[model samples]
Target: MPPPPARVPDLTALSLLVAIARTGNVGTAAHEVGLSVQAATARLRTVEQQVGAPVVERERRGRRAGRLTSRGVLLVEWAGPVLDAAADLDAVVAALRPARPGEQPIVLAAGPTAAEGLLPAWLVELRDGPGGQIVLLDTDDPAAAVRAGDATLGIVETVEPLEGLHATTVDTDTLVLVVAPDHPWAGGSGVDAAELVATPLVTRRPGAGTRASVEAALTAAAPDVRAPAPLREVAADTAVRAAVRAGEGPAVLPRRAVTGDLAAGNLAEVPVHGADLGREFRAVWKEGSSPQGTARDLLRIATGGRIR
Candidate 1:
């Protein structure tokens, strides 16, 4: 005979753990899940008590998110799929006879920038076809979404290598430094990798693909030096561009992401002297579950038969 199974924490607390994993800050994750700061803190403490371990590690140099502890990461990985499955069951039970009149659901999970900057036009094109239901969820962590069975397809900014999921390169791109026309960096040919890292700059949040590319490049360019940090992290490309235009700080963004501003003369692209920072956009999904029907057709259309 086996002993009784270990008791798990409440679902709400488990959800808070996953939220903390996503945002990396307890307060922010709490607010996202509609919990007050004190309540969130108490819930987290309760979780810690039950698990007999700390869930997160926080650091503040002014204000920014910190990293999750090993236990917290593990719990998030376990909880995401469970929560998603629960939600699915709820929806199915609510409708009892769920059927769309003329639409199939396409759940697309994407990194923040691509979700906002890239997919709008492509989604418009998709809408013209068979008129399926399109659901877009914004998440910086695409890999988690795929693993949790949340998104039918995912678009990520980097192609470094993600395990568990089958990823195909949809596009190749380079990171470009963008600055206001009047800024000092705008007049130069490009800033060297060392100088760029040394300088203060505005950038996307930590989990963003743009940030990932810059960090990777800086590391490769100067293996001995500490990687650069963002002077400020904004959630949207529009905000980052606005702040750069206002002379807040220089930023490195995808060439495709800021093409319009560069063409309009609202921003100038400064090259990174010693770093290529080339990245690839990938469409990812779980193994053995290739996108089928409309999803597959749209994938082909988006990539134009190019997969790699």
Candidate 2:
């Protein structure tokens, strides 16, 4: 293959050529791309020089506007995909750019528990410090959001390892089995893992980090017993809390989520014997791409000034 062209018309010049082809008016095309007619004329001349061809035929005295030469028409057609690809690249870069420090509107994705319980405080701390606007996405699958470039950073509570992402433990939380005040387990000795695994419990819907962590803990504690399905699967932590408060069933949830209720005597925490329900609150980003700028500042706040 021959070497690439050492010089080519830039995107703006190529866009002008395409616009001229569509509008069939040099001045209108120039205006569309934010250029004065005279400056556009000069740019067209430069493009022609770079391409070694005349790309436009100037408007004659009687004609209303100028039109592209045959070569110009071909150049516009060739630049179509190039311009499209450049636009696509620009969008991707914009999506990723917010992760860089100082980018506005830092996009953050967080699991339901963190969004409801933790992020408010962290955001308040961020506002008090190196502050910037933040777009908070409350999601069940925060890792997916970060991986897809929809979020600059993600906070998740999970026991499962995240693949292809850089994760740092920002905090630790425990999943506790909680029941309404009147439930049998509320007053009795804590239930064992086998019994806990056998009971149907209200829970967050599948794919939620809390639900996954609870399931993993149960399965680990009772390898031979398949954990029963949820009594009711709700979309949000608040819904799950409501369901449990209404005496729907027991739910294993992040302690932080039910702390207020527990304190208010609306919910009772039940111990799960021989089961480890601890999980880490982690901040995750795309592997090889650490958080920067406002995102870094926010992460620092989340981790209490420790970023690792």
Candidate 2 residue pairs that clash? 101-293
Report the C-alpha lDDT of model 1 over 1-308, residue by residue, as the tens digit.
Answer: 23654657777888888887777777888888899978987887787788898776655662324467888889888888888766544432332233357655777778776766566556555555544455665688887898899888888876567888888877677788899999888878788888887877898887787787788887788667665567898987788888888788898887887899999998988878787788877889898786886678668767875554
Residue ranges of candidate 1 with Cα displaced over 4 Å: 1-104, 227-229, 305-308
Task: Give each model a TM-score.
Answer: 0.62, 0.62
Clashing pairs in 1: none
> lDDT tens digits, residues 227-306, model 2?
76678988878888889898998998888888899999999998889999988888999999867888999888987898
